[model samples]
Target: MTIEQEKFSGGVAVITGAGAGIGSGIARRAGEVGMTVVVTDISAERAEQVAEEIRGAGGKADAMTVDVSKPAELDRLANEVFEKYGSVRLLVNNAGIETIGYAWEIPVERWEATLNINIHGVIHGVRAFVPHMIKAGQEAWVANLASIGSFGIMPVQTAYMVTKHAVQSFSECLYLEMELAKLPIHVSSIIPGQVKTSIFDADAGKDEPTSTARHRQIMHDIMKAGGMDLAAASQVILEQVAQNKFWVSTQPEMTEALIEGRIAFLRDQAPPSLHESARQLLEA
Candidate 1:
């Protein structure tokens, strides 16, 4: 069924990580569409900044500080938003952290932090918001941010890759469950290739070994050069979501080839070279 754009007007949209990058881009688009945008972030200042910007541009907006990794905070956010707005029409679980290192070489704390924010954060959002959305009986949607890494392998990024893969799987299951229950809520897995974001600069301020620093530098350079514009990518994502489409891919052609290569490998062909795939993506 085709979803009309008017459905978003006057709707309540809560977006995690709305302080910067892709999240901020999505928040701006939501505001432009006349949605009451709730810009939530771990950084209170940044969240407030985004909320104010939206209001300045003639949209309804609010700011809230929420650490999505914490279930209590997310639950409280849900309660407060529902109390004020009465219902939520969109939930964007976009908060995530990146840990760059081989699976075994990464510190335990880093791995835990990555999983808590990237995977469990989305889980907590679903747990806290789905019930309320159901009770409200409003047409709603959840957009979970995964990555191209969800379907492809990248060396020294095991932690980020693992969590993104989990998000993809979780989103798929959520879609099926909602369909089976005949719920009005829709779910989407936002599988983006690189978008211009500071996520790659995460390791810049860290005191890491020479090799780790070098690796991060290489990644940072590649992404900076090739990543899609944050605004453009966000627009593509929300457009697909408005249509209730799943598999929200930013770079569809590249993503399709990666998935096809994975299938080919599973069919007993020569394993696709991860480095080759990454090189092509970086060049693209």
Candidate 2:
């Protein structure tokens, strides 16, 4: 048997934003590996659909509606999961929205949503669940979704970039905390370079500035053309998580390049400059 099966089989996995995209892929993979999967999303219908797919495949799964933007909801979710499952083997804080536009141009509500969902969501997920994990005294895994945007600066994508940076830092500190406490929990920062998803779809960007339609379309096309396969990326991520690695990246080369650029920018104290492709996309 594979390492993932050895570590995770017959355990319970709670994943946020499992209705679609990478979250859905990971939930499916968890089920495939013989875990009982709890698939959660803001949309009840979508969450149930994904859970049903897993059940149909002869895997165990359940669906729940969870809005990660609300800390209370996360608390309730943790309470319920622990009460029902006895213990959680894995928890993935993966619900996030992409906001595209100039920082000043984005609406207050959208900015709050982005920050609350992307940053606070991950924070509260840990806050609500770690105590249970500690009390259970079982080896558990927590994976927070970071991105390539975590390392670099972006003009129009400032809101999204800010949250990613925060998440990366949070994950780093969380890993250290686990080590300091000598807990049986493993923390992983999942840095995905580009995997196929609907983050930039027109409907997903309805809260952004109307003028950003072109930029959103451009990014959507780019993802469609060059993004990694969702299932393949999920498999890589889980394999690394089972190994208890802190840095779980879908594309290590891209992560390395971004980190290098970030280092140079910091070392030289360079002003932020837009890449030519970003310039073209914004100008188009």
TM for every model, in the order presented, reads 0.92, 0.98
Positional deviation of residue 187's Cα in model 1 after best superposition, in angstroms:
0.9
Instruction: State which candidate has the highest lDDT.
Output: 2
Global lDDT scores for all candidate models:
0.86, 0.94
Identify the runs in model 2 with alpha carbons over 4 angstroms from their true place.
none
Worst 10 residues of 2 by lDDT: 210-219
Candidate 1 lDDT over 1-284, as tens digits, reads 12424667779999998998888989998998889999999999999999999999998899999998898999999999999999999899999877776566776777777889999999999999999999999889999999888887776667788898899999999999999999999898898888998887954326333345556767888889999998899888888888888889999987897788777777886755666656675444
Q: Which clashing pairs does model 1 show?
A: none
The TM-score that candidate 2 achieves is: 0.98
Please write out the lDDT profile of model 2 over residues 128-222, one tens digit for every residue: 99999999999999999999999988777889999999999999999999999999999999999999988888999888998666777887898
lDDT of model 1 at position 238? 85
Off by over 4 Å in 1: 1-4, 202-210, 269-272, 277-284
